[model samples]
Target: MLEGKVAIITGAGGGIGRDIALLMAQQGAKVLVNDVGASLGGEGRNAGPAQSVVTEIETAGGVAAANTDSVADASNAKRIVQNALDAFGRVDIVVNNAGILRDRFFHKMSDDEWDAVLKVHLYGSYYVSRAAAEPMKAQASGAFVNMTSTSGLIGNLAQANYSAAKLGIAGLSKSIALDLDKFGVRSNCIAPFAWSRMISSIKVDSDEQAARVEKIKQMTPAKIAPLAVFLASDSARDVNGQIFAVRNNEIFLMSQPRPVRSVQRSEGWTPQSIAEHAIPALRPSFHSLDVSADVFSWDPV
Candidate 1:
């Protein structure tokens, strides 16, 4: 389905990015493997993983190239996309799967820790997508799939920064999809629950963590790759501005708010009036806007 396409995959060295890149290439897309080889916490690195993937793809008779540029830097982001264009004649798909985790409780979170995660997960995607959008716009056809997580959709202790960035990715996806639709470019997001090197050696501090890890362990990162492949394929030409959660073999279409309930005041509006009349009925449903629906009816299906 991805035949003859050129795809740029950030953080393609390993984990979900690696899986997505290989899957797209196996489906016949020439892939650009971009990875800075940063550690799980976005610190330290080696270039081995990035180069290794390129070699593997080449050995398998697939067209692929390795780029060690950091996605968080705007210039490096453009350089990575340009590298793909230089290697292949054109660019068709971009998968922003590069991310890092800096976990800490809200009270104890350091400014550096918060900034680091935001830079990678939010700004990194922004930089790369901005760079890729130009080529996509010119081609009048392209797909952009950003990696998000359930932690962001919901909430997870010690992951405030990560969650915020992931949620921001969803917002970015929707906005970009709206803007790029005129150019026939699609933007979407994936909230995947999968196992990867980042969490392979992680130590669970409690039974809750153990249970959470066990639940996610059942969902391999490879299972999530097919959705990405589909999104980048021609079959998804009409599928844009959507967010999907991939776990195990199941693909869950996430929900968003769409003005489902707007209880206008029969009485004069005031904080006191809202608290008295609206609070009871609206509180439960208001917060439920975060995630509750088959798929958001914001626009079409």
Candidate 2:
């Protein structure tokens, strides 16, 4: 579907990013696989992961190039995009799947944890998209598939930093979609539930936890790639500023943010009036503070 196109997929070392890169290449896109090759906690770095994916793509008769650059760095992000432009002479698609997990409860979360997570997921998306936007705008065509998370869309017990960054990404994508719509560029975000290195790192304690882990193992990261590929394809030209969720065999189009209820008083009400009148009027539409796990307590259908 992406024949002759050029795509830059960040975090393309392993997991969801790797799967997307391979799928995009198989669909005939020249892929620039970008991976800093960091661990799940955003520690250490290696070139093997990125290069391995590139080798697999090439061996499959697909065109791909490897880039070992950290998306967390603005200059490195620009370099990653530039690598794609230099190699393919045009930027057609960008998949901002690069991320790191510093899971910690909000109270226990350290400053470094917050900063690191935000830097990579939020700022990284901003820098890469910012660099790619100009080229895409000039070309008057492009697609962006940014990685968001249910943790952000809903909420999570731990992972305050991650949730914040993911939510920011969703907002950024929507704004980008609106800003670049005139240029014929589209932007969308996805909250993917897949078994990857990041997911596997979660500690399994009890028998129930073990069973849950096993079930998650069946939800391979590869299963999440097709949706991303489709979103970046010409077939989804009219789709923009939307959010989606992929779990096992299920794909969900999430509702965008909108006001659910409103109350008005002709005579400008005070705080007391708001608490007395408006609160009751809007109570029925008030959503519970349920996290992703709470809402999706059942197994993936």
Candidate 3:
């Protein structure tokens, strides 16, 4: 579906990003596979992962190249996108899938831990999207899919830093969607629940975590690739600013932060009065957890 297009995918060395890169290439899009070959928490390095994907794409008769640039840095991000342009002549799509996790409760999270996650997940998206936007603007056609997570959307314990950064990507997508319409650049986010390498390594102590992992183990990285592929296609031209959840062979349209209902003030009220009045109104609408829904069930059969 992405025939004759060129795509740049960050963190394409393994897991969801790797799956996405291969899928895009298979669909006839020339792909730039970017990854620093880091660990689950974004530590250490190996260039092998990115090269492997490139090799797979080439073996499958798809055009692909490898990039080792760190998306966490603005300068490196620019270079990553620039490499795509230099190699393929233009960038028609960008998948901002590069991320890291510093899983720790708020009180125990270190400054570096917090800063690193934020920089890679949030700022990394910003740098690459910002760099790619110009080229997309120049061409007057482009698609961007930013990878968010269920943890980011619903908030997971001990993942405050990771969640904050992921949620920030959602907000960033919305704002960029508004600004890029004039340039015909479409932006959207995918909060996937696939069991990738990162999620598989998450330390699960409590029974809750165990059950959650068991459920997620049913979903694969390959299943998450199709929505991302569609989002990067010309068919999704009007699907801008939307956040989607991909899991268990389902695709759900997720909601953003919006006012549910409001309470009117009888007078200049105190905190207790507002709290009492607002609790009932907001309780039913506020969701602590997002129930799984299958939004993408049928395809052309």
Candidate 4:
């Protein structure tokens, strides 16, 4: 589907990103597999993971190059794109999947933890996308597949930082789709329910939780690659700025924020009027404070 294209996939060392890189290459795209090789907490780095994936690709008769660069840094992001250009001469697809987890309750979260997640997920996405925007504009065609999360789309406990960043990525993807439409650039997001290093961190304290974890385990990271490949290819040129979720073999077109209910007064709302009139009028439509798991309660199919 992506014949002759050059794709840069950040976080391609393992998990979802690794699978996407492999699939992209198999589809005839020359891939730049970028991974800082950071641990789950965003500490330490090694080149082995990225290099190993590249070797796997080449051994399978696909084209790929390994890059160990931090997407959290603006300069390194540009160089990542540059590395792709140097390898294959043009940029066609970008999958912003690089991320780290630093889970802590909101009240107990530290400044560094917050900053670290935002820097790698939200800011990293922006920096890389911004750097690639010009090149894609010049070429008059491009696609972006950003990694969002249900944690942000719905809610999650003790992931204030991650939820904020993932939700920000959704908005960022929409903004990019709107801003770059004229340049023929498309951006979309995926909220994957896959079992990876990130999801493996979920604290399970009961038998019920353990069963839920087993269900999640069936939804492997590989399940996410096909949708990402489609979004990054011309096949989805008409599908831009949409959010999707994948669970096992099921794929969902998730809804974006839109007005479901509204209440108005000709004289405009007052504190007293809002309490008596508007609150009651809109009460039925108010969303619950449910977490991601609550909303995605059905067993993975």
CA lDDT, every prediction?
Answer: 0.86, 0.92, 0.88, 0.94
Candidate whose lDDT is highest: 4
lDDT of 1 by residue, 118-207 (tens): 998899999999999999999899999998877787765678899899999999999999999999999999987678886674579899
- Tell me how many residue pairs clash in candidate 3: 1
Candidate 1 regions off by >4 Å? Answer: 201-203, 284-301
- On TM-score, the leading prediction is 4
Q: What tens digits encode model 2's per-residue C-alpha lDDT throughout 62-178? A: 999999989999899899999999998999899999998888889999999999999999999999999999999999999999999999999977889999999999999999999
Mark the regions of model 4 whose C-alpha exceeds 4 Å error after superposition: none
Candidate 3 segments whose C-alpha is farther than 4 A from its true place: 272-301
Query: In terms of lDDT, which candidate is stronger, 1 or 4?
Result: 4
**Rank ordering of all candidates by TM-score, starting from the highest:** 4, 2, 1, 3
Residue by residue across 129-181, what tens digits does model 4's lDDT show? 99999899999999999999999999999999999999999999999999999
Winner on TM-score between 3 and 4 is 4
Q: Which pairs, if any, clash in model 2?
A: none
TM-score of 3: 0.92
Taking all chains together, the TM-score of candidate 2 against the true structure is 0.96
The pairs that clash in candidate 4 are none
